[model samples]
Every structure is written in structure tokens, then in C-alpha cells.
Target chain A: MRTIKLTLNGTSVSREIEDNRLLVEFLREDMKLTGTKESCGVGVCGACTVLLDGTPISACLALAVHADGRAVTTIEGIADGDRLHPLQESFLRHGGFQCGICTPGQILAAKALLDANPHPTRAEIQHWMMGNLCRCTGYYKIIESIAAAAGAE
Target chain B: MVPFTYLEPASLDEALALLAEHGEDAKLIAGGTGLVNLMKQRLVRPDFVIGLRAIRALAGISEKDGLRIGALATIQSLEVSELVRRHAPLLAEACGHVATVRVRSMATLGGAMAHGDPNLDTPPALIAMDGQIVARTRRGERTIPVDRFFTGYFGTVLERDEIVTELLIPKQPAGSGTAFLKFLPATQDDYATVSVATRIALGADGTIREARVALGAAAMVPVRARMVEAALSGKASDEKTLGDAAPLVVDAIDPIADFRGSAEYKREMAVVHVRRALVEAAAKAKEAR
Candidate 1:
């Protein structure tokens, strides 16, 4: 076990976790922030996407200890008290999801993209969001949602 | 993942000491993008995982005499670094094509090189550009030429106590051009079926003075095609010369039949891509002239 002190969402968190505890598990179980899902246990599926120091990374592949002293932002932290983030609103407005297992990851990944490149082209959005797979919506709605959010922002 | 003891060392000296004491039973993790996956799959189960994230010394990208990229420097940093883009654009381009933006954010150059995965994009580019990997142990430091670094699939010459410190990429000489071409028939994030990296240096008369060729996913390791290099050297930098040298890589490569491509198909693609990479590099050399 190790004591990891990190900033999650907005709060500073310090916890003792097993050495092998994955970041996804730490967020879901320890912190009870279940918005970040883990579909592909490996890094490919991007369902475990979270921002580490403002850059997106696979929570499943990253150990909890690796997040020590780092800032992590997940879907749970995307909205204000009553308002949704621009991407979240856009996702809903654009009907960007169906069955919604991949929504949290998709929105968080898009958040990272927009944060870095404010007005990315459709191609840029596609390229950046390629890792975040959406099996239900067939991708067009998600792409449109991200593009809409870019314009709205 | 199986339970293990995670050790974080605040300094390089401490990390080295920990490695020296427990490296045999431990696995040094930088980004954890590679090693963590292996551990989760039960492919690798080490009792101790030495976390190098806290060691501030092992991170950054700078251009001094040449490109000195710290081992812990993320691949995303290299892709966006102006120093890397200006000096070794081939490397920058190769780094950009690695898995995904998220993976690049966490995967370190040292981890990729030390992972010794032949299917990776950076090795061929690094080999073509004459990059050397800097490794350190309690004994001291030593530089391993990128071409000779990989011993086999997922293998390197690095000792148990040794950890890769940084990668040194020599600046390209004047009148030289480099190109890294990855043939990804599947998806952009998928590994290349047969990728090629070529460097062509033009002589005063526009003849090839020196040429280097390396391929990824072509063999157990990144295969450096010396035969193709030899054939292209002293020859006219033209399509005919590229065509003649192209077949030489088939003899050099030992591709396996995988979902990406059949062995015979990859062999053929290797020739095509190698020729195209050489031609593109030669054109750049002429343009530089």
C-alpha cells in the first residue's frame, strides 16, 4: 500500500491504496466518482480517459501511484453546480449518444481537445477523438456534437 | 493487476540505488502506458514497481549539441516541441503517429525504445537518423546505437541494473534528408504493417553520398537495410536507383504473417514503401541542395 496525495476534479485528495490499484479504480471506488468507465481494460478503448495535469491519459493503464501529486479531471467534474459543460450540453443537444456507455469518455476526450485547440476542424476533431470509440451512435452525432461545442465556445 | 509494492524515488540517485537493490525483482515504470498493460494482462508480474515519475531530472526536451530528450519526456511533448520539429522532423512526425494523443501524453520515448517492440514507429525513425540511446547504471553511463540496441522481440541489451536515461539524436548534416513512412492499412492508431524510415545524403554532383534505411514490423527487431543503403550510395538519386535498391530490403526483412498483413504481402509492401521513402528522402536532399 502507498499514500498518494493528488488533486482530483477540484479537491485535493490524499488516500492510501494498494500499489496495483489502477487510476480508474481509484476514481470509481476510492473517490466514488463512477462517471469514468472502464470498457477495455487495456488502453485502447479510451472509456477510461481522464485528464492528468490537463492532458488525456488512460486511467485503466495508469496506476493510482502515478497520479500522486498530479491533477486529474474526469466527467464528474465537467459541469458546474447546475449547468453542464459546453461539450455535455452539446452532446445532449446534438443527440451524441445512444445507450450511453461511451458518453463520459467521449465528452472528457472532447474536453481535452477543445481545451488544447479551441476551434479544431472536423478532421482535427476526428483525429483527436479516434481513440474514444462509440459503438451505438455510429459516430456522426458525436462528431457533430463536438463541432457544435467548438462553435458555441 | 496483481498486487505489488510501488516505490517512488525523488531523485535519479535514489532511483538507481533502488534499481541496484531490487531491479531484479522490480520493473521501472515511467509513463506506465506500456508496463501497466503487461502487468494487467499477467504478461509481466514483478514484485516491485519502481516509479520514476517523481525524479525531476529524467524529464525534458532540449537541443544542445544535438537533440537530448530525457527518458521520461512524454511522446506528446516531442510531437509538439519546436526544437524536435525544427531539428528532426522525421522523429517528430513518427512520434505524432504513435497510438493516440492520450497514449502519446503518457508514453515516454525511453519506454518505447526500451520496450523494444519491433512494431513501434520511433525505432525505425531513430535508427534512420542515427540516434543513440543513453543508459546509466551505478557503474556509469554508456551510449548504445539505436540500430544495435534491440536484441530481439521485446528485448534490449540493457542490463537489469541499467535504466535508459535519455535519447540523443544527432542533428542531420547539411545536404541530407530523412523520411519516415508508415503503411497503416488498418486504422491510424493501429501498428504499421510495414513502415520505412530513410535518410539520403546527396554529394556535390547530386549522387547519393550516403543512405540509411530501416523498417519497423519487418523483422523481430527494427531491421536496418544495409544492403539497400549500399546499393543506393554513389548512385544517381532517381526512381531507377530507388527501384534497384528496393528489392534488397526483401532479403533483409523477416516479417511474420499477422492480421496486419501476410508475410509475403508485407515483404512486397516493404519494397514498395522503402522505394517510396528513399525517393522522398532523395527529393528532400536535392531540395536542401
Candidate 2:
């Protein structure tokens, strides 16, 4: 076991976790931050996408110890108090999700994209969000949502 | 994943000492995009997991006579680095096409090399550019040419105590043009059915002065198309010259049949892609000249 101190969702937190604990397991199981989902445990599916130092990474592929002294942003941290983040609002406004399983990852991944390029083109959005799979096949809506969010900003 | 003790070494010396002490019992973890998955599948169960992220020395991209890419540098960093794009545009192009933005953000070039996965896009690009893998151990440092670095599937010539420190990629010759083509019949992010990277340098007279060709996901290891390169040497960069030489790649590759393609299908695709890559690179070389 090792003690890792990191800033999670803008709040400083310290925890003693198993060395083998993955970032996804640490968030969902230990910290109760279930907003991050793990699908296709391999890095291909971006269901467990989270922002590490403002960059999107597969939480399932990252160990909690790797988060030490780093900043991690998850879907639970996307909202401003009770008000949903613009991306979240845009997703709902544009019917961006169907089953909602991949919604958190999609939003977080989109958040990282918009943070890097505020005004991404349709092609840019597709390229960035291509890794975050939506089995519900609501991709057109997701694209629209991200575009709308970019425009809203 | 099975339980294992995690060790974080803040310096290269400390990391090397840890490796030398643990020997084969310890596994190095950088970014974890490749190693974590293998551990989850129970393919690699190291008693000690050494985290290399804390070592500040093994990060960043710098240019001297050639590019010095630190092992801890993320693939995303290389994809966006102006120096990388300006000096080795083919490498930047290949890095951009690795998995996705997220994987690129976490996968390091050194980690990718150490992982020794033949299906990866960067190795062929590295091979084409004459990149070298710089490894360090308690004994000393040695440079292994990228083409000869990988011994077999998911294997490298690295010893138990050796750690890849950086990738040294020599700048391409003047009037040289390169192309990286990944044949992805499936999803855009999927590994290539057959990937080819070619570098062609032209003389002032527009004759091919030098040529380098390499392929990934086409063989057990990334194959350097020496025959194709030999065939193109001193020849005019024309369609027929490239066409005749493209088929010579079959002698170097032994692809495995998988869901992406049959071995026969990949061989055929390899020839086709090699021709296309060569043609594109030749055009670029002419423009460069």
C-alpha cells in the first residue's frame, strides 16, 4: 500500500490505496466517484476517460499511484455546483446520449477537446471523440452536442 | 490485476539501481497504456512495479544534430511538438495516428519502443528515419538501431536491467520526403492491416540518392525493406521503378493471419501500400528537390 496525494476534481485528497489499484477502481470503489465508468477495460474504449493534468487518459490503464501529485478531473467535477457544465447542458439539449453509460466519458473527452481547442471544427470534434465509443450509436447527436457546446463558449 | 509492490524512483540513477536490484522481478511502468493491459490479462505479473513517471529527467523533446526524445515524453507531446513536426514530420504524422488522443496523451515513445509491439505505427516510422533506441544500465549506455531493436513479437534486445532512456532520431537528409500509410479497413483508431513508411531522398538531378522503407503489422517484427531500398537506389523516381520494387517487400515479411486480414491478404496489401507510399514519397522528394 502507498499513500497518494492528488487534487481530484479541484479538491485536494489524500488516500492510502493498494499499489495495484487502478485509477478507475480507486475512483469508483474507494472514493465513491462513480462518474467515471470502465468499459472495455483495455485502453481502446474511452469509457473510463479522465483528465490527468488537463489531458484525457484511460483511468483503467492508469494506476491510482500514478495520480500522485497530479490533478485529475472526472465527470463528477464537470458541473458548477448544481448547474451542469455547458457540455453537459449541451449534451442534454441536443439529445447526445441514449443509455447514458458512455455519457461521462464522452463529456469529459469533449471537455478536454474544447479546453484545448475552443472552436474545433466538425472534423476536429470527430477526430478527438472518435476513441470514446457510444454503442447506443448516438454519435451524430454527440457531435452536435460538442459543436453546440463549442459555439456556446 | 494481481497485487504487486509499486516503487517510484524520482531520478534515473535511483530507477536504474532499483532495476539492477530487482532484475527480472520488477517491471517498469510508464504511462501504463501497454503494460497495464498486459497485467490485467495476467500476461505479465511482476512482483515489483517500478513507476518511471516521477523521473523528471526522462521527459521533453530537444533538438541537437538530431532529435532527442526523452523516454517519459508522452506520444501526444511528440504529435504536437513543433520541433518534431518541423524536423521529422513523418514521425509526427505517425504519432498522431496512434490509437487516439487519449492513448497518445498517455503512451510514451520510449515505453512504446520498450513494449516492442510490431503492430505499432511508430516503429516503422522510426526505422525509416534511422532512429536509435538509447538504453542505460548500471554497466553503461548503448545505442541500438531501431530496425534491429525488436528481436521478436513483444520482445526487444533489452537486457533485464536495461531501461530505454531516449530515442535518438537522426534528421532526414536534405531533399528527402517521407510518407506513412496505415491501411485501416476497420475503425480509424484500429491498428493497421498493413502499414508502410518510406523515405526517399533525391539528388539535384532528380535521381533517387537514398531510400529507406519499413513496414509494421506486416511481419513478426517491423521489417526494413532493404531489397526495396536497394532497388530504388540511383534510379529515377518513376512509377515503374517504384512498382517493380514494391513487390520485393514480400521477401521480408511473414504476417500472421488475424481478424484484420489473412496473411495472404496482408502480403498483397503490403505490396500495394508500399507502392503507394513510395509514389507519394517520391513526389514529395521531387518537390523538396
Candidate 3:
């Protein structure tokens, strides 16, 4: 087992675990932070996206041990107490989801994109969101939700 | 996925020791795009995963006289980098065409090259740029020029207990232009069927001095067409010359058949991409001159 300490959601947490555990498993099974989903388990489906030191990455592909000394952000961390993040609110208002399994990943992916390029063109948004696939919504509403949020800011 | 013992080495030396101790049973996990997919397929059941994400050696992009891209630099980072866009535009070009935004965010430069998947886009482009692979183990570090790095189908000269640390691309001598083009991912879970990378060096008189033409998914490893290179050498930069040389480009290739296309079809498309890439490269070279 290895010990890892890192800031998650602005709180520093330390834990000891086997080295081979996947970061997604550690977050969901150990920490009970279930906001991050695991869809493909192979890094293709973006359902496992998390911000590792401010960049979005598929946590499923990263070992829990690698998260040592690195910062991580999940969907649970996106909200301000009871108040939802603007991106989350936009996702809700714009019907950015259907079954909701892929929403967390989609929302985070959008956040990363918008944070970097606050006012992405429609085509830029589409290209950036290419990795995060949402099967139920066909991505029309998701793009609109992002465009609306970008416009809001 | 099969059960495995995992270790996240605090330093490169620690990682190399772990790799040396485990040998073939140990595999480095980065970005997880390639290995995790293999795990899902039960194709690889590594008993030990030597995680390098924490090691400082395998991250970030810095430049000197030439571009120095850390092997662990995620494709996403590479695509968004101002340095990459300015120094090695073709790198950004090749990376942008990879799977999608989400995958790029974590897929490392090292993992992609070490995996040596022929269908993957970066190898051919790097090969054309005369890229070099930097690898390290507990013993020491060494470099392999891109052309000498790949051995065969899904094979690389990277030794056990070694991890690729960086991919160094030398500055293009002034008066050179590079272009990379690829067909979309038409097959399920496969690399691009045909991808082409062309680098053209023009003389002051606007004649072609030297050219590099490489194709991926057209051979066991990404192949450099000697015949094509010879045809372009010392030739005037013109449409007819590149067009005439396109067919002979495949003389050096021996493609394998898969669901993407028949071997014959892949070779024919290789000709098309090579021709297209050459024409584009020639035009860009002329513009640069």
C-alpha cells in the first residue's frame, strides 16, 4: 500500500491504499464521491473525466497511486454548497442530459473547455467536445447549453 | 480487468528499479487510453503497473533551440500549446486529428509512441520530422532516432525496464515545410487506415533539396518510402513530379489486411494520401520560400 495526499475540492485528504487501484474506484468506492462516472472503463467514453491538476483526464485510465500529490476535481466539487455551478445550471436548463449517466463527464469537459476559451465558437465547442460523447441527447442541447453559459459570462 | 500489483514511483530511478525487478510482468500506465482498452479486451494482463504520472520526468513542454516535448506530455497539452503551434505546427496538426478532445487530454506522447500502433497518427508525422525518442531506465538513458525506434508490427526497440521520457524534434532548417493528412477513423477501434506525413526542404532556387515521405497503417510499421524519397530528391517542385512519384511510393510497403480495408485498398489509398500530402507540402514549401 502507498500513501497519497492531495487537495480535492479545496480540501486536503490523505489516504493509504494499494497501488493498483484505479482513481475512479478510489473516488467512488473509497471516498464515496460518486459524482464521477465510469462508462467505458477504457478511457474512450468520457464518463470518467476528472480534473487532475486543473486538466480534464479520464480517471479510469489513471492509477489511484498516481493521484498522490496531484489535485483532483469531480462533479461533486463543482457546486458551491447548495448552489449549483453555472455550467451545471446551464446543463439542467438546456436539457444537456437524458439518462444522466454521462452528464457529470460532459459538464466537466465543458467547464474545462469554457474555462480555457470562455467564448468558443460553435465549431470550436463541437471540436473540443468531440471526446465527451453523450448518447441520449445527440449533443445539440449540450452545445446550446455551453453557448448560453459562455454568453452569460 | 485482471488483478495487478501497482506502484507509483516517486522518481524515475524508483520506476526503473520496479520495471527491472518485474520485467515483462511490469507495464507503465499513462493516460490509460491504450492499456485500459487492452485490459477491457483481456489482451494484456500485466501483473504490475509502474505508474509514471507522479514522476516529474514525464510531464510538461519546454523548448530550446529545438522543441523538447516530454513523452508524458498529454496530447491535449500538445494541441493547445502555443510553443508547439509556433515551433512544430505539424505536431499540433497530427495531435489534433487524434481520437477526440477527451482522449487527448490524458494520452501521453510516450505511451502513444511506445505502443507502436501503426494506425495511430503521431508516429508517421514524427518519423517525417526526424524525431528522436528519449528513453530512461535505472541503468542510464539513451536516444533512438524515430526511424530506428520502431522494429515491426506493434514492436519497438524500447527495452524492458525503460520508459520513453521525451520526444525531441529538431528545428526545421529554414526553408522547409511540413504537412500531415489522414483519413478518419472508419474502422471500429483501429488506427487511421492511411495517414501521410511529408516534409519538403527547398533550395534558394526553389528546387527541392530533400524530402521525407512517410505513411502509417500502410505497412507493418510506419514506413518510409525510399523510392518516393529518391524520386523527389533534386527534382523541381512541381505537381507532375509528385504525381508521377506517388505510385512507386508503395513499392517499399507490405500492408496487412484488417477490417479497415483490404491490403490492396490500403496501399492504393496510401498512394492517394502520399500524393495529396506531397502536393500540399510542395505548395507550403514554395510559400515558405
- Report the number of the highest-DockQ candidate: 2
Clashing pairs in 3: none
Residue B88 lDDT (model 2): 94
Poorly placed runs, candidate 2 (over 4 Å): none
- Comparing candidate 1 with candidate 2, which one achieves the higher lDDT? 2
- What order do you get sorting by TM-score, best first? 2, 1, 3
A47: Cα error in model 3, Å: 2.0
Off-target runs (Cα >4 Å) in candidate 3 are B137-140, B185-190
- List-wise, what DockQ does each model earn? 0.84, 0.90, 0.51
Please tell me which model should have the higher TM-score, number 2 or number 3.
2
What's the count of clashing pairs in each model shown?
0, 0, 0
- Candidate 2, DockQ to 2 decimals? 0.90
Q: Of the pair 1 and 3, which is ahead by lDDT?
A: 1
Q: Which consecutive 10 residues in model 2 chain B have the weakest lDDT in total? A: B52-61
lDDT of 2 by residue, A1-153 (tens): 889999999999999999999999999999999989998999888999999999999999999999999999999998999999999999999999999989999999999999999999999999899999999966999999999999999
Q: Please, what's the RMSD in Å of model 2?
A: 0.8
Please write out the lDDT profile of model 1 over residues B80-128, one tens digit for every residue.
Answer: 8999999998999899889988899999999999888999999999999
Docking class of 3: medium
